[model samples]
Target: MSPALASALAAELTRRADEDRELMRQAETIPPPDHRRRIAQCHRDNAEALATIVRRHGWPTAALVGAPASTAALMILLHAPDPGFRRDGRDLIAQAVAEGHCPAIHLAYITDHCAVDEGQPQLYGTRIDPKTLRPYPIRQPRDVDERRREVGLGPLQEQLEALGIRV
Candidate 1:
């Protein structure tokens, strides 16, 4: 990546992350139902901004700005309002992984998040149950640990435990 491109990506991603944090904090003061909607709207707006970057420069590869930037970009897109964009983000992440430009962890995140968004059971247990505020059950619960390992993620059960959740 050119210095100009790298500088731009770093600055823009930083701004988005900062704005997202601010909005999430603001949303916390809002009542439920509306609070999540407010937060989701913030994500949608951020994702739209990121979409502009994607349109201008294409997928923000890890080679361009390191894995964290790439991961953050994918994460915003996963929460995008447009299902097509969400699906496209997932596809782009997969291609990036295939080309060795992104980590497989990015793919796993988008996959599981998109599945939950589509009302299917997530494969990696990444989604939370909105009502219970707990990690949602995986489609194949028995093999979730193995699947998580395949993507270099630690055991899902332990992660949930750390979150004050069981199973």
Candidate 2:
């Protein structure tokens, strides 16, 4: 990757993070409907911009775009409203992970997100239900921790405890 391209991607990632943080900080103050709309709009816009980057540069692996920018790219895809787009991004991320270009944790999160979106049990219990403060569902609850461990994630219970869920 060209130095200029990397720098530009990093800058864009920083801007996206700043905007996301600001929106989240104001979420409680904004009415629920408006807050949801603003969040959705931001996700859509970021996903669209990331789509262009993906088309031009593929998955933007850490080696190509640096770790922070690559992780930010994954975050944008993870928050996308469109399930099809998210699944496509998941595939790209999975391939990148297989080739050691991206973090395994990225694949873990996106895999669970896509599965939940499709109404299927997630292979990794990485997605927690905010309402219940528990994992949404796992393919095999008994083996979920093993699956998560393979992907560099801690046990689901531990993760919940870390979140103050008292699991």
Question: On residues 1-167, what C-alpha lDDT tens digit does candidate 2 reach at each position?
Answer: 78998889877965785687688899889999999999889998988888888898888788788888888888888887888999999999989999999999999999999999988999988888888878887898999889889999998888888888886
Model 2 bad stretches (over 4 Å) = none
Candidate 1 Cα lDDT to native: 0.80
lDDT of 1 by residue, 8-97 (tens): 796787677766777677765778898787778778788888888888877888888766777678767766788888888888888888
Report, for all candidates in order, the number of backbone clashes.
0, 0
Local distance difference test scores for all models:
0.80, 0.87
In model 1, the clashing pairs are none
TM-score of each: 0.87, 0.94
